[model samples]
Target chain A: MDVFAFFNLNELAFGLSKLPMFPYFDMAHYIISVMSLREQPGALCVSQRSPLACWFSSMLYCFGGAVLSALMLADAPVAPLSNTTNLLLATLMWYLVFYCPLDVVYSLASLLPLRLVLTAMKEVTRTWKVLSGVSQAGSKYSDALFVMVAVGWAKGAGGGLISNFEQLVRGVWKPETNELLKMSYPTKVTLLGAVVFSLQQCRYLPIQTHHLTFIYTLFTVTNKTRMMLLGSSSHPLSSLESFLYK
Target chain B: MDVFAFFNLNELAFGLSKLPMFPYFDMAHYIISVMSLREQPGALCVSQRSPLACWFSSMLYCFGGAVLSALMLADAPVAPLSNTTNLLLATLMWYLVFYCPLDVVYSLASLLPLRLVLTAMKEVTRTWKVLSGVSQAGSKYSDALFVMVAVGWAKGAGGGLISNFEQLVRGVWKPETNELLKMSYPTKVTLLGAVVFSLQQCRYLPIQTHHLTFIYTLFTVTNKTRMMLLGSSSHPLSSLESFLYK
Candidate 1:
């Protein structure tokens, strides 16, 4: 009950106190969404203005927004957090130690729209400023009950160092073998080269609907055809801007 | 804007209505959660207390609870599903068709505890019945925004039948090759056999911590292990349980 009470009371205290605390939670949000989209291109990648665009957009915007608020309350740092102001200045040590290994990124995304709907009853009566105020406030605090998961190979921090040490002690490998298992110099160079190549391809892809259609159709019919796109943000518009205007 | 209004106004109506329509939404809530957990077991599964017990209990209680709800909402062919329920239901369907292929399970688990905190503030004054009623209502609705992803090869719903037809029409496959990709007789039987093997292993594993330690530690270490399990929902207790009783 004390554990429950401390969490509940501090939440009330958090709502009453106003400070910009949104970025911490947002940083921890929706890893699975980003990862899956990156990993599963053959299955999930969708072109814009297709029948799937609105769906993807809502998911990216709303469900994406959903994860930003997952830890707003429960993860209020034990002390000094009840009155936190600077969102970005703190060290991320909490994630290193107390992180629950659960994948809780979707919890917030799933609930956010329902919260909006429930709040809509007041929309007829409340001013736009008031609603916007609530949303702005919501953005500052991510949900707290769930854990950010131990970091992964992608982010480079999931206690793999400790595990590797323990495994080494347990006689999984000899010291010389372990050195061989690590990424070699050529592998690192190849990885860097691949990233550069993909980024270069992003610039040449036809972006506009008609331009892309004509170009792609021509390419498909040609005796020798080639196409390339890499490092494009899921949204083609953003990808186009990355190479062009930006 | 029309999209936004249709969703908002209907939610307004849903809140006003007091009908018992809990079964549908719960069905859609946990697919994202379950999928992520299953996919990232190395990162997420906690091996503590009665390891198999927690795993099996969570599977039997939640997954078993889940499939029951899936049929409930998907089969809501009953009439008078409210301007509200229809809005919620149709939007969910839209998500299914246009769903981002990203696994969204982590999003909900992260957010649930935070919502609990916010609710706790009101709980200070509210009657227990009111809190339970709200919780009961919430369980029925599940998380509303995230899509229950369309069933695919992972969940076994993407039939190779239509895919083959589309490929044939596109001249991408010979009909014979397409037929070959579909499951053959022995493959289907072997798949069934694999599932049976897994469930059997699940049953035989030390779901009860006491039985497991007594049986295994006795076999391996032959002496003792001192483990402290503060809380374990599986087997209703831990190794200390056997010492307490039989």
Candidate 2:
């Protein structure tokens, strides 16, 4: 109900107009540059912040609001609509519904429930690390495991859409027909896209931005170089023994 | 190797007094929260000038930040040298290393690449809506469609940790073992928790806070009415066409 309610007002308008407006307004392009600038020395340290970052984030926020408002509007405004635009609009709006909300949740978690999110993140990593280590020894089904993770992630991304639709059809259509639609592949694909988009969005910063570039460069050059120099020698033999014995 | 490296850091810091002091400083927390709060309210508002809404959001942001910072520091100062603390700290620290950084990446996709996120969310919903409609009166596995969607979203939520770990481990560990760890049961549990938490938190405000009394009222009335009406229906079918046609 909430999902449909969010989409009902925002869906069409957000899909067609508000989503594409940013790129046209040059805000997206400018943000690309501004984010790059933010990483430069003294950019944030200066009293005046980088205008590009400010404008870009703000403009995107504004556009997001417009899309959201359109979603909330009770009546669809009469306008000439095109299929291409519909596709584009639908895509953009869908992404927001799936991913944007999670970002907020993540950010909030990082700020408030940091431990919980962090704990969850840790377990996921630990699981991967262990599995990857085992696979290195030529374990069977390693590839399958990898595929499973990837496919699983994709499915998760689309889950929200499916969940919401379940709710929506319960109200709109007969219960019996709703059951049949659930097994359809196309339906699964769309839901997967939404869930993936949202989850994917929750985890990363944009590339080409200054902050990301700086962090990537630092990790690639510094830690990578250090590891290269030390190789496996820096780790104690006692640690190696445990793995061997175990 | 990445896991080993992360573990090593946790191991090295064995005592409470040995923990890093900088991340726990009040000034740093305040500054980050203040800036984030200022940015987020404008970021979250459905309208550009929802000043009051922004103000309210700012408070929530502040509250969230404070709680997060405290949690971050909870195990900090490292608890005094103890096996349990070590395990807890190691687990917590390892988790953080594995997953937290991915948030930056996901944020990028949702914020800067807004169009992509929105589009994906919509497609997912469309697919879900159709499938849910079709699944009505379907077989047992048809109901699994919903489970699949739920699992898919969980993977999406946990994907950041998986991807980041994969990238980090690529240079160090063999790939096969890496895949194994990704699909392990612990990871599944972690994912399940994330989904539950996200759903619960999202619903809390709507169901518990805003409509606290409404839920209870509905619960009471629905239960009583259902019981009263249960035996009134002769065959549990109002129309012969519904049962006979099927």
Candidate 3:
């Protein structure tokens, strides 16, 4: 019974609307972003800062905050919510949940180890790029790799909805189902993002890339199948992959 | 008339399947990935390559390939032509179009400089990370920024499909519409992915971060709203936003 409850997205998502202290959460995030800290450079380490880096870094924080703020407001009182608000909120959530995690854990305080949110939050922090500049190709390639996974997941999710819009419509119409759909899809995206990054990171482990690819393809197959066969299938890839597997 | 055709997803996506030769393309990408280029690693240039870095590098190629393969197989000999395949293909398409461009252009050479695809692919290449060693915290923080944009995009697309399932279902049932859906969603995802990246990259431009955030949140509101109002919203945020916008 306990285990079963954990698997239920609906039950799990029900409490999300009542998330506590979002202002605090956002505030903590803001303070962390505004203050810039530099580590002592080693003899081996070089210090190169882009003049325009400030603009890039600042807006990221603001936009990210905007997104988290939107999510926090999800349970708040945005009177006369517009279709536009919902879309922006959704877009922001997708972006934040998937990529924000790469930097989240570093900023989160130890005192507020909230378990309820940890499932989603841990992912935000779990991936930390061990910083060592290999080359421009290396850095750009890393960015490219991240883009691939995020895009791959997007592709899967988008297609799933297109083919099965009826189920989505039904879920959206139902309160708990709708909320679960909203929360779960991002969770799935976050998970997929992490998975892709990790798989890429695994290459650092010495396994041949093609071998890893085979395993990844299999994992992609299995993981996707599981999403379709088991859960409500928030994403297109999961549902579709599972559908194909069957 | 030609201009209008150029804008058409169907017209553009038509030749994607018969790509002259994938092996050569992959070979070109491998060379590019291996060759390290420099932009301007002035302030701090750091080079740290974990032995494991290679593993991470190789798998991305495979995963990206896997996704493309799965998408390519959508219309192939996967018997029964089930719903799951359709869903997976759609999701993959969404993910691919949005994010695949970054890697696509470098590998795609002169033959298929297809105008529309180039617009998106060029953005992918334009936003390269000028890599040098930053301190661990610095690199990690930068990683964090990247995470935010990626996750936001994922959330937008996932939610888009879920809310607009009916249109999706109808699209899936029809070949032209389905093809357009498959092609267009990825294009949207790529465009969004690139946009998020460019905004993040603006940090390199030497502007004050706060001014950037103020401008950013406003831009976020407008850009998201614009996305919602125009086009066949492939992203949840767009459709939902448009729904509320209307």
Using TM-score, give the best candidate's number. 3
Put down candidate 2 lDDT per residue, B1-246, tens digits, no spaces: 244256563243233223232322222222333333333323433224454443333333223322222222222122222335323432332223223465442244335234233333322222222222222212222333223223333232222223223223222222222211233322333333333323333343232221222222233234323433562422222244247545
C-alpha lDDT of candidate 2 relative to the true structure: 0.29
**DockQ of predicted model 1:** 0.01
Evaluated at residue A148, the lDDT of candidate 2 is: 33
Residue B102, model 2: lDDT of: 58
Model 3 TM: 0.22
Instruction: Report lDDT (Cα) of residue A65, candidate 3.
Output: 23
For residue B32, what is the lDDT in candidate 3? 30
Report the number of clashing residue pairs per model. 25, 72, 74
Please list the residue runs of candidate 2 whose C-alpha ends up more than 4 Å from where it truly belongs after superposition: A1-20, A23-246, B1-172, B175-182, B204-246
Return the TM-score for candidate 1, rounded to 2 decimals.
Answer: 0.17
Tens digit per residue, CA lDDT, model 2, A1-246? 244356573354233222223233232222222332233344343213222223222222222222222222211111101123432443343233224544552244334234233323322222222222223322323334333333333222222223322222112123355423543332332233333322323333232222222222233234323433555323233355468979
TM-score of every model?
0.17, 0.16, 0.22
Clash count, candidate 2 = 72
Q: With candidate 1 superimposed using the best TM-score fit, by how many Å does residue A174's alpha carbon deviate from the native?
A: 28
